[model samples]
Target: MGTSWSLQAVAPPAGTGGGVQAALDRVVAQMSQWQAVSDLSRFNRAPPGEWHGIPAEFAEVVAAGIDIGTASGGAFSLAMGELSEAWGFGAAGPVDTLPDFMVPSDGGIDLDRDARRIRRSKGALLDLSGIAKGYGVDLAADWLLANGVRHFLIEVGGELRGEGIRPDGHPWWVDVEVPPSWAGAGWRIALHDLSIATSGDYRRGLAVDGQHYSHSFDPRTGRPIANGVRSVTVVHRRCMMADGWATALTVLGADAAIALADEKELAACVLANGREYVSRAWREMLG
Candidate 1:
């Protein structure tokens, strides 16, 4: 929610740009943690023991987060709002120079999709920063398509989704940027009918007492991730899935991330310890 967005498209209907912006705005209104009155913020502040109803869009994102967290073996956790705040990356904004980090005893959120309701354990707080931007991209893309734009590439933050072809009759090709700290070459891929997301901390790494910390945190330890992984990129039909998988794989590190990516047949790339690990599906996708 602190970043920007852009769209490249063929001739679209009048006001298509404004339409896309409006769509993205809807996502922020429903999910921005920085906004104290957003649906996500309200959910984070909800009292325990009661099911709180959320907007459909917010519920959809939460459902996706739960699915990803479970599939990644807890590598991608949404119930870390408090931890994120403690790490100075949340809505609370740099709490007195990072308080003694508290690992919540109950880091669990129960979601009932049928009724679009959720309840979290006392110490658990749900945060969707990992996947919300990609959802925003998908929402904007959908809005464009519904309004008669057949070819476009939409990006929010760095996550992107593409549909059809450019006015030049070429697929939307994007060159993935390598983390500046990594020497590995990045991949350039066609984004036609697909979405791509990358997670990395080279630009956001924190240093405290001579120890470097990655912005990616491990919910299990309630601290910044110490995994050697420096970056992870994922491609999927849905930007939300791509975004969530990128975060999950980054937290899982190289070996486990590659194994899971292969098992799931996900298109993923991981950079760790000065080496690049590319999943089998990633090669096939580019080929």
Candidate 2:
């Protein structure tokens, strides 16, 4: 939520631009951890075991997060708020002593869909930074479509979702950044009503005592990932899924990540230790 958002839409109504911006703003207002009064912040501070009512959008994102977390076998977790804060990624800033290792409580979050309520058990901290941006992009795309725009590309903080063809009849194309530590040109992919999200360790990491700590925290180790994988990019029908999967796969490193991507038939590309690994689905997509 602390990042840039852009949208390119065709034939949008006169006032539709403001609507799209407002849609993204609403998502950030509801889910941003930087804001003290945000819905997610309040829910994080809410007493455990109490059902805290949340907006429908927030509830939906939480449900998706839980689903992905379970599917990744806890590789993707929303309950790393404390770890993030300890590592100076959160509002609390850096601390002299690192917090003790703590495994995320996978099933601690309970959501009541009918009531639009969420309750956390075992003091699990909730952090939605990983997936909220992608959801915001999806919402922006929906906003454009609902406003009579048939073709659009929406990107929030690098995660993107595109639908329909460009006005010139060309598919929406995006460049996958080549890691700074890697060689060769970045790949260009055509987006045909699909979404792509990439997670990388080269950016947004901290170094302490000559050791690099990535922004991605592995829930299993309660620490930032120090794996050989440099980046993971995933393409999916929904940006939210792609966003979450990219983070999960990055945490799993190159081999396990590609394995899971194949098992799920996901289109993913992994860059690790100066080499590139492409899944079968991704190869087909490239072709």
Candidate 3:
């Protein structure tokens, strides 16, 4: 419920161009293939014990997630599958919970790069909720570009990235959704060669036993982040960075998130408690 995306490429409008239609079909098929979260979800399941091989894409994404998690101080780990599932946030978990926070600290995952294997030492699940969608968006954009489409805007599951300028010579526009009650406040970003992602607890909330739980979980604590922030949006040159930052900031809450964005010079907008705090870099990018 966070965000969904669409792609508008300057090839001929759907029915008007046969070649464009075929290319679009190819891109759609690719998106579908990579978005599945089942066993096919490369980030969901750990490698079998004694199994040392993985698909190239799986290896790549895992490596990327590990890097991001480390960089974010373990704020964006892939080892959240078990906790998410236990709380019914997984393909098998319940969506009902009154408590928003869960205890942190769980088993560890041992990743072997040379052997191309991952071992969940004590059996924790891996969930790539923060970055997978952005990865998919980037993949779609790459597919379109490689297929000879120079100008396009791709949005998938609320994350977006733009390639080239539109025929109008303006950068693509993507709106950052603020809580509806926040009057007259919106953040719209212009992008030509960047990807933007927004994460929020406004939706996908679970209510149980007089408590409400957010969908965003903290890998360190193995529970939902109690950050009262409504939304966090990040814009970056890499779709993966934008995606992960949006998630990391959402988990970090508004104040700390803004400070971190400032320290890192990441373009960001944080909405919380009926107000918005925008990073200087993000404000500059808008102009």
Candidate 4:
């Protein structure tokens, strides 16, 4: 997403506070060290059948991504790495000239559940950008909690997670960025112990022959979704759930998102045709 991020924790006393900052700094550094897509990424070279000995925090994220992918009927795939690379969404440089969209064939990937290992046919790359930011947010929040900070908000890119209460005892407040359609609307949400993520075609888009191509690609078709829906925001107890659900809902469109949210009792907001459709669960939480 390349969006900015800032981490906040409950203010601590003079001498005690420094340790919390140091801990957060260390966590951020560790996250950067394990980033699979960065220039110094280590996960890319992980040997097949090897667990990579990732921190528990990172492993939980991988497991959650797999679950969300299964829930979305593969709409949220991590195995579309090659497709992303071809479209210049990978570490590779931008496609000097974008190619016309073509449906890609899926390479059947094998995930070793107990081992937490992954194997794919050659050319299969794992793309975690969609879910990793939320995972990072969760890690930041965990870091705060472990350091004795209870009331806090932590975000990576645009994903946010908050817990306990603010120093003033009010819920943490956040706003879903109303797209161009919902302009002139003031809609900040008060949240506590909830993570929220919004996926929109508005960010990181490419234009080809006057058509906007979203960064989100459908794994089944290997093409940016043509759905008219503008944005999907999912709120849940875990940042990973909110992040992955938001992406899946973007691919599924408004009605499916509403239905799924209702079935799962999830908090969701969908934007279509300049109108917003929110789930009752979300409404209840907002209230």
User: CA lDDT of each candidate?
Assistant: 0.86, 0.85, 0.69, 0.70
Candidate 1 on 76-95: residue-level lDDT in tens?
88888888877777876653
Models 1 onward score TM values of 0.96, 0.94, 0.82, 0.84
By lDDT, the best candidate is 1
TM-score (C-alpha) between model 4 and the true structure: 0.84
User: Where does the lowest 10-residue lDDT sum fall in candidate 3?
Assistant: 26-35
Better of 1 and 3 by lDDT: 1
Q: Candidate 3 residues 15-69, lDDT tens each?
A: 4334433533433332222345333344334453434455444455567788767
For each of the candidates, the C-alpha root-mean-square deviation to the true structure, in angstroms, is 1.4, 1.8, 4.2, 3.4
> What's the distance in Å from true for residue 11, model 4?
1.7
Worst ten in a row by lDDT for model 4 = 31-40
Candidate 3 error regions (>4 Å): 1-5, 12-51, 97-101
Instruction: Encode model 4's per-residue lDDT on 1-287: one tens digit a residue.
Output: 34466656677435444553454444344344234443214554554333344555555656777787787777887666666666776666467557665565345345566765555554455566777777767766776677677887877677899888888878899888866656546358766888999998887666767777888887778888877778898888888789988988888778877887888788898887677888989889755
List candidate 1 stretches off by more than 4 Å. 95-98, 102-105
Model 2's TM-score against the true structure = 0.94
Please report, as a residue range, the 10-residue window in candidate 2 with the lowest summed lDDT. Answer: 98-107
